[model samples]
Each structure stands twice: as structure tokens, then as C-alpha cells.
Target: MTVNPGHTFARIAIVTVSDRASGGQYEDLSGPAVEQWLRRAVAQPCEFVRRIVPDGVESVRNALLQLCDKDDIDLVLTTGGTGPAPRDLTVEATHQVLTKELPGFGELMRRVSLEQVPTAILSRQTAGVRGRSLIINLPGKPASIGICLAAVFPAVPYCLELIGARKMAEALPDSGA
Candidate 1:
């Protein structure tokens, strides 16, 4: 499968996992940051679905599954719950629902973040695929989202194509040239 650049808009889901944010104790900057970055980077038209959930493995897992399986979201970006803290279960929850893991996204995110903070090594941000959707876990900080998104977005369009959202017209070529 190949995604045409002219294909219809993609549906994106943004999930913010923070007990304080979910409880109204603090505003969610991370979710908006993700949305803002998507707006700037994605050339294709897109719709964003936002959610703020508590920091728990089940909550994160359920939200991700629902977005991919039920909402038919093309991409799901999560913020917060990616650190070494006790409540940081985003990586684990993501691991549970993903059909395939994309370790390079996490590696590149940390690599880019390391330029600003040594603590970047402690973050557990990750990415994976569930059905037709691609899910990426990002740190809570707005700065980190920009760094990670720049590092990994080069592959997003191609990945979306491989997942069957669009098509290419190239004739079949021999596997071994």
C-alpha cells in the first residue's frame, strides 16, 4: 500500500496522561503542543481528537485501543506518563496493545532530547502500530514534543502508506534487481 499525497485528511487522536491535568489541577500543555506540531508538520488535512486521562496503564491502554480499533484513527500521539516516575506507564501500556514496535522512533526522540537535557536517557517514550493506526508516546514537556516530532516525522507519511490508508500506482518490480 502507498499513500497518495492527495489523499483525504487523516484523523489524529491526542491523549494526555496526567493525574493533575485530568483532575483539573493543571492545564494540559502537552496535548496542545502535539496538536500544534501536527498542524505545522502534516501537509495533509487532519482532524484532531483530544483526551485527558489519568496516569495509569489501563487508562492509557484502553484509550489507545479505542482510538485505533473503534475510532479508526490514523495516528495517536500521547503525552506525559513517559518518564521514570512511578506513574509513568505509557511505555508498558503501549507495549500491550501494539501489534508491532517501532523502536527507532523512541531512540531518535531520546537522541534529540539529549541535546538539551541529560535526563532524556530516563524517558521511556515509544512508538508502535495497532491495526491501521500508528501510536507514539511522547514526554510531557512542550519542548520535548517538538524535538521528538522533528526527529521521527520523516517516516510518518510512509508508514501511513504501508498501513493501507492510500495507494501508489507503480508497476510491480522484481524483488531482486
Candidate 2:
């Protein structure tokens, strides 16, 4: 909690839940997209830790627990495995670890995403609080990552503050990508 105490920098983790990416069938672009978006939007010194886990409830659960409960990460952004596909279990895995389910995050994300594509409703992206960390499930596509973050990240700092994370501000600029 509070980002290692006395440290102004935030330690964030980007977990990519993709079987293909984890198995080296394809490169992971979603995780880096998250890092890039946060770097520009947060405007604070941040240390990012990236993890690639295969799509599954167990893998996602394990990775989230390790980062939120053990790694001292302030924020955990999970990409991939958020769709309605059989293997998209990120939301369920995230639910298992959360102390509070913030459904509004998913609602807002889907609402905004619907403006871009109708299939947005198929995404199960959600957010929650586990310990002092904020975990948010994001769509796997690089473009959708930015879209969802823009809709929800404005509240991330406040949510983190309420959850006893390090006090910080997010300067979210217009994500004109």
C-alpha cells in the first residue's frame, strides 16, 4: 500500500492474458499499449511490471494475486481474455480476487466502446479493488485499451486514494489516437 511508503513513484503491473502471446505464437501488443497510455495519461513517475499469462481463470487469478498481494503493485491493468469467448475468463478471475466489484467501470467502458463498435457489448471488462490495489480488466485490442482507459482512468486516482494507495493525480489528455 501507499507505493512502498515515501516513494512518489507508482508501481503498476500490466498482465497480458493471452494464450497465443504466452505461448509465443504472437507478440503481446495490448500490455505495452496499456503502459504507453498510462505513461502519457498519468504524468507521474511510474514503474511498470509486465506479465504474460495464458488465458484461463487459474492463470489470471494467480498472476493478479501475485501482483496485488505480493508484488506491492499499486495498480494492476489486465488486458486480453475479456471477451465472451470460451477462454475469456479474465473477468471471472478478477472477480474471485476482488474485495469490491465496481460494475460502473464496465458499464462506462461498454457505453463508450459501443460508440466505436456494436460488438463492444460482448466485452466483459470490469474493475475492482483487491487490498490496496486497483485491478481493471481491459479489452485485448490495442485501440480498445485506450478507449476504455480514457473512459475510466479519470476516476482511478480517486479510487486508489480511497483504497489507501499512494496519493497521485492522473492528467488524462485527449487520447486522439
Candidate 3:
């Protein structure tokens, strides 16, 4: 894939999986939260492709695959469906379409979350690479999303670069004559 520097904007897909949210019983905070965080964190311009789906493996899997394969989304972040609940199938869905798993992301996210809440262990947040897209599953709670993103975002840019995205130069001091 050719990296379009002019298209410096990252195409981000935010998916929130919750039956209630999808049904409009409550606002989809998770998706918006991710978009807010991305807008703040990334210097590159970004466009959000958002979705709110029910907690079903097939739905999650299809959404992920479509975003990566068809939409050509650079990053797909999903919230909800990563818990121990029977409907929590995000991790499995993510694994289904991934060519390779990035285990460190889940480990690091859990570790960061564990500092804030003991029940963080119950979270099964995970990440993987499909084609050139990187998919990360996060907790449904807005706060946990922020914490996890902070813990993992440092590596995201580098990972994107390694995946053949645009190069980000390390800041250097210039001596002006």
C-alpha cells in the first residue's frame, strides 16, 4: 500500500458493540470517546467511520473485516464485548480476521487498567493485525478507554510505520545560523 503523505489523515473506524447502544436505549459513548481521544492524540488529521453493533461474534467479525479489507481503514478500535460475559466476543471476533496477533497490547492494557481497578483482570481487551489495519479491542467504559489508549498509543505510530504507513520523523534540534 502506498502511503499518501498528502492524505496525512488517518482513517479510523470506531465500533461499539452493545445491544442497548445499538438499539438506542443509550447514547454510544464508547465510539465517540474513541474519536475524541484520537482527535486529541494524533497530530495527523483523521476521519472517523463509526458503528454501533450488537454483541454478536459475527457482527463484530464482519464489521472488522469490512473496515480493514474493504474500507481500507488504518486503525479499527472496538469497545465493549471484551468482558467475561457470554456475549463478550470481541477478542474472538478480532482473532478470526487477524493474520497475526499482537499479544503485548492486551497484556499492557490489562496491566495499566489493573492499577485503577482490580476487576481489570476480567477485561479481555486484545489487539491484532489484519492486512495493513490494526484492530484493538477496549473496554466499554469511557475511562478505561482513555487509560488503555495512553498505555498503548506510544507504540501505535511505530506499528503503523512498520506496517508501511508514512514515516514520522523524530524531532531534532536545529541550530539556526
Candidate 4:
């Protein structure tokens, strides 16, 4: 995975797992919210790919596989389908494709969300590594997206570097030129 691709930029894929969003019952706000947050937090240029999938194991799992395996995305962020409901299956789908499970990401997100809402305990957010890509499951609400992301995003760049997703120094343009 040549994450740098001769430039200091990142390719991020946002997958929104929601039946309502996918079925056009409502607009996909959560996906856009994640994109907005990343654009503000990340310094480097970013190319974003967005997808909406219904809430199910197969739908979420297939989307994740395509993004992680075929899209060459450096980071994949999924919103929705992490709750305790019967339809919630983002965590399970994510687990199916991950080579390494990073439990800390979910723990930190739940802990931070718990501070804002007691029901946060029901959220089952998780994160893991698939090949060179890092995939994270986040709560569905647009309001909660920023809170959870802020809690975990500080480590994202470092995690990506550790996973060989990108090298900070290599990604930088040569100043001597």
C-alpha cells in the first residue's frame, strides 16, 4: 500500500450503515458529518469516497470488504449499525474482515460518549486493521459523530503510520526543492 502516492494526501472512505439512509428514507447525514470532521481535523489533502449501505451484516460486510480490499482506502470510517438493536451489525461485519482488532478505539469512544449520554453504553463501536487500511465503527447520530471522532482521531495519524498506511516524513514534500 503506497499510502503517500507521491503526495501528502489521504484517501478516506466513509460508509454509512443505515437502512433509512440507504433506502432513501432520509438523507445520509452521518456520512457527510464524518467527512466534514475529517476535513477539518486532517491537515493533508484528502480524497473521500462515500457509500450508503442498509443495516445488515452482509451489506455492511460487503461494503467494508470492497473498501478495504479493492478501494485501496487508507482509512474507512463507518457510522451507524453499532447499537444494541437487532439490525445493528457493523461491529460484527467489521470483525469479519479485520486482521487485528484495536479494542482501545471502541473503549475510548464509548467512554467519551458516556460522558454526554448515559445510553452511550449501548453503543458497540469498534475498530481494526485490514491489510493497510484502518476501519472504525462509530455511532449513527451526526451529533455524536464529532464527539467520538475527537476522542479517537488524535491517534489516527499515528496508527496509520504504525500500520504502514502512510509515513509522515515521506508524505511531506521536499522543502529543499
- Report the poorest 10 consecutive residues by lDDT, candidate 1: 168-177
Estimate TM-scores for all models.
0.88, 0.94, 0.90, 0.91
Candidate closer to the true structure by TM-score (higher is better), 3 or 4: 4
Q: Write candidate 3's Cα lDDT for 128-166 as tens digits.
A: 888778889999999899899888887887887778654
Identify the superior model by lDDT, candidate 1 or candidate 2.
2
Local distance difference test, candidate 4: 0.86
| Candidate lDDT values, in order | 0.84, 0.90, 0.84, 0.86
Writing each residue's lDDT as its tens digit, candidate 4 over 1-177 gives 555456356778999999998999999999999988777777667779999999999999999899888777888999999998999999999999999999999999999999999999999999999988999999999999989988888778898888887532222222211
- Candidate 1 residue lDDT tens string, 79-176: 99999899899899999999999999999999999998999999998898888888999899998888888778778778877876532121122211
**Which regions in candidate 3 have their CA more than 4 angstroms from the true location?**
1-8, 166-177
Question: Residue 1's C-alpha lDDT in candidate 2?
Answer: 39
How much is 34 displaced in model 3, in angstroms? 1.1
Global Cα lDDT for candidate 2 = 0.90
Q: Model 4 off-target regions past 4 Å?
A: 1-8, 167-177
> TM-score of the candidate numbered 2?
0.94
lDDT (Cα, 0-100) at 128 in candidate 4: 94
